[model samples]
Target: MISTQKSFEKKEQGSLYLVPTPIGNLDDMTFRAIQILKEVDYIASEDTRNTQKLLNHFDISTSQLSYHEHNTNERTPQLIEKMLNGQSVAQVSDAGMPSISDPGVELVKAAIESGITVVPLPGPNAALTALIASGLTPQPFYFYGFLPRKKKDLVASLVDLNKREETLVFYESPHRIKQVVEQMVIVFGAERQIVLAREVTKRFEEFVRGTAPDVLEWLENEQIRGEFVLIVEGNSDIEEEAPQSWESLSLKDHVEELMENQDLPSKKAIKEVAQLRGLQKREVYAAYHEINE
Candidate 1:
């Protein structure tokens, strides 16, 4: 590994700062974030009008240039050029961290490739804010910002992610929450636990925790509004399930499916498993037959 110690030295070029804004309640805004916004030469805002209200509240006079999804291709290079000219810039999304389910990641990636210093200021985030209070295992959580919207892609994503053991977090919209939860019930099974945090940090903020079926039932019953952050409980028995991934099937399940469907014998299935996963025959045999004895 090529390692380089970054001495706390000053760079002659301007730095790109990723400043996090409040998710909902404005009181969650940090002092340092406000100071950085004030100090920066220009602000790259996801929405200039939305950010203007924030700046007005904090008494910051930094000029904003729109940098959103529709205009990112044209605007990213311009922002990079501004920073390259030794002008410090702060990028802020509509809410929460700039790149979490928002724009600015492309700009951040471009800035880093150009060796520009990228500074991230800590502040409010909807996912973590929901996860910590979700009453689920907090450590080793997987933050998947948003899921694929299409039916096939969404199924494929859930199939791949269902086998993970870490707590899973996802940002979802209000309109699709019901259908998403319903799909989750189908893909992840009904017994899997989940924490549904809605309108987080807002006046109508609410968290509903239960199994997949339970939450699905709740969504069916309630009047859904605002955005959502889904904290899903991962597979409880991960070690056994992790060694091999054959379309979300266990090594043994894959072997069994092959045997049942393709009319292969136990030995043939085990050999196929070895060939496919690069596992020793004996190891496959052990996992398949539960040969712990």
Candidate 2:
């Protein structure tokens, strides 16, 4: 059901405003955003102390409540209740837009379930800022926020992500950029073109563009600092290889062939064959182990 309400004109309960703050430069803050910050009754901030600086600079004296990941479970209901009682609220992150790899999404969902209005304001974001100048395809892009920290899970995730056909965008910190690119080279191949946009909208802003191997070479000697937005070209040359013939092989032999060819463990290879043949995992397991017995 698509329900539309005339924002700022309808007379009812309070609204939830999602305001965007400047990513780095203070000058990027819009005038209307400043007015909304001042006009709202209370602000739900990711970091109250960090938001105070932005508030103090514009001389906006709105009260704030800490609403980060750690406190969202307890704070979301309180914020929703306050809005239900007709107290206007504005949600903000430490920087950039609220709920983009941030903590405002739960609160927004809570508010909507309770029938409170949500009003989102458009403004600065790190990913799009870097992408427009990245010289990569902007449309049909995938904005995959921070990659997983663990190497195994990260590699597995990248293995699945490597098949995507659209340009991929990601946010990465300085410390992991080099290692992350190295891993990308393994999954996506060394010749895949990638771009790193660093410290956007700030004084030392930079855009580094090259193949994955080329960037890995640059990171060897230079000191890495600042946050990063990575743009990678899609796999346009994905080869259409023919599937291996399983017609002549029995169930046990097919599982063995997959284990050797795909470098999969017995259990994993059995599961793969089951999925490929629309058979149950237990059935494949039984067939494979029967030969071993």
The digit string of per-residue lDDT tens for model 1 on 165-214 reads 99999999988888888889998887899999999999999999999999
TM-score of 2: 0.85
Candidate 2's C-alpha lDDT? 0.91
Report the backbone clash tally of model 2.
0
Point out where model 2 deviates above 4 Å. 1-4, 241-276, 280-293
Give lDDT tens digits, candidate 2, residues 171-222. Answer: 9999999989989999999889999999999999999999999988988877
- Where does model 1 exceed 4 Å of error? 1-8, 238-293
